[model samples]
Target: MSKKRYILSVALIILTLNPIFSQNSPKTEILLVGFDHLGQMDNGTPSSDIFSPKKQKEIIKLTEKLRTFSPDQIMVEKEPSEQKQVDSLYKAYRENTLKLSEIEYGSSETYQIGFRLAKMLNLETVYGIDHYESTSQSLLSSGKNIDIFKNGLLELMNTARPMKKKVQQDSLSIYDYIKTINQPKFIDLSHNLIFNLPAYVINGKFSENGTNTVDIGKIDEKYIGAEYITLFYNRNLKIYSNILNAQLDHNSKRIFLIMGQLHIGVLKDLLEANPNYKIITTSEYLN
Candidate 1:
């Protein structure tokens, strides 16, 4: 082939391969910020009152730090079905026509963190990516020799109680408390509490009374503590799906996900597994 013809052929090949190569590149940087429920919503976990002026000021400073990430999208732990309602409120808030505190929205991290950050960044709207699934406690009640499971759960709560109390009693800022909870040490401990509770039952920790024996033949049919953990996993998976469904183009789109602290562990695992995303820890930005 002539030199001119060869050059033209090379250019066409590069054009054809550019998109394929780019597709393999990670374009989305996601900062998964695990936060406590500011509204005190009942999740069997301790809650805080974030509506005070001092707390509000702290939140603003925290948002300022997060703004350095320059996120293009902010995702909150609200249900996907509530996106329209959230968007409406966000739009009003951005226009300065609606005050979030006047409308019973002050207690939620969604408004305090997500909405505040979006406004500070001059973004249009915040995205809600929450999905709810009820984890039935009836399983705990039904098993014959389930005292082991009950004891295990109580131990787990007891383990977490001090940290919860410290946050409230020590007068730590909401940002500091969240930063502590999202640390790798805390995340791993939390995961162990959830997974180990069920494992205790499976390992026959309650078998001393002969009442703790789970029917091996009917294991799949019966409800167990592990199933409770699975429910939480499923919920986080659905929330991740909602995050993905937002359909942001994978080209350097920075996503900030503000969610309950417990969710951080699972969501981090899921996001880390995806090639399209690069996970950013709260420590990286908060510091």
Candidate 2:
């Protein structure tokens, strides 16, 4: 009834609604689904290709379930060199969404699981990993110090060359990816392959498994055992930290990360630390 009373009441109402408004605002949710390798089967055991009939069907089913979360954005680990290729593949798929099932795996070497998922969900996708295509060229071109990478690659090539049976002309530096990752076993494997048979090491750029080869200096026969053991356990935690930092900054309501099982150990640790996120496994979706 009184002017002062009315003003005070209005102020209270505004304060109450502010929190609600803020809560409803758009935010980012990042889902990372890491597979062992683009495998031949749903078990993720080196499927022929992500778009294989079986793989597509499984992905369709998975998408149907992931759609329940209504993710705002999807991100996949794609190399920059592959972006144009991915775009072309996506263009072809978008042009022929109907025949996607019948298309062969090689139809578009660029398209993978994330591309199809984004297409099915009609969501935006991003290539998160900072990979360079001509890392050697880039290193040579860099104005800043390049020895870290240049020398690293040279040393890696020299040490690993002996091991490689036949080297491919087109190879990229995996040190960038490997350095970002902190897995002991992966490092050990890289070390072993680089030192023992460098030529066969290819590009040293396997997804999370460290199956690919990038040159690293000789592995100390004695230290190899300890170094790998340490890396195996440590890699997951480091990756978890990177993922957390990337995801928490967004306004995503439900985020899924597809990563290797080895990374699961790290995710477990993260879920324990952050109470806000509700971690659900693929099996949980089955139920």
Candidate 3:
């Protein structure tokens, strides 16, 4: 082909690939802010009383810190099906018609952090992206000759007990404890607790010449431990899906997700792997 023809052909090819290239690039900046549950529910973990004047003030401070990110959308750990209820409560709160003490909008993080942040940013609605699967620790103890696995879990709990007690005894504010938990070391530890512990019990106990007896009972126990871990993973996967399904403006959307600290490690990994998102660390905002 002539020089002009060749140049025009190349230009056309570049033009054709431009949209695909852009599509592959990151468009959204997601700040994954993992927070402890605010309501102090009976979830077998230490719960914070966020209703105190001191904790409330700290929450305000936390909101002020998060406001610098100027997130366009705030996502919470509530299920997607609950969006209508969340939107309704948010609207009422915005209008000064709903009291925080009201049963409809309790001290839950969805209301405390997510709703408060969205209001601070002047956003109309907060998004709910949680998916729940009934999980039971008893499953790990169900099969025979599973005492090793049970003991391993007990040991893990004992490991975490001191930190929990120290946080309570040191009089660390809810904000301070949350900040500590979001740190890299703590996040890594949380990840291991969820992913590594199960694998250790399953692989170490069930492998040939392992600690546990190589019998049908041990195999079943190993499978039970694995199933328990799988439920944890599946719940996080669905939560990530709900995040993606949220209706967000592509032009200038920055999403801030407020979720339980336990969900953060897996969700962060999933978000980091997606090309459509640029994961923003909590340290960047909190610091």
Which candidate achieves the best lDDT against the true structure?
3
Cα error, residue 278 of model 1, in Å, equals 0.7
lDDT of each: 0.70, 0.42, 0.71
* Candidate number with the higher TM-score (1 or 2): 1
lDDT of 2 by residue, 180-220 (tens): 22234443333343233222222222123333223433543
Candidate 1, which segments miss by more than 4 Å at Cα?
1-23, 41-49, 136-156, 203-223, 247-252
**Quality of model 2 by C-alpha lDDT:** 0.42
lDDT of 1 by residue, 1-287 (tens): 99999999998878556743345554588998876677663234333446556667777888898999999898898887887888888888889998877656566888978888999999888887888654433444435446665665566467566666665553567777777778898777666655555544442211222222222233432445565556567677888888887744333378998887777787888888876678887788877
Comparing 1 with 2 on lDDT, the higher-scoring candidate is 1
Q: For each predicted model, how many residue pairs clash, with residues at least 3 apart or on different chains?
A: 1, 33, 0
Ranking by TM-score: 3, 1, 2
Q: Per-residue lDDT for 1-287 in model 3, tens only?
A: 99999999998878657742345544689888776566753234333445656668878888888899998888887887988988999999888898677855377778888778888878988888888665544545444435655666576566555655554443666567677789887777667666656654442223333222112332445455565567678778888888887834334468888988878899989988876778888888787
TM-score of predicted structure 2? 0.44
Minimum summed lDDT over a 10-residue window in model 3 is located at 209-218
TM-score of 3: 0.77
lDDT of 3 at 74: 87
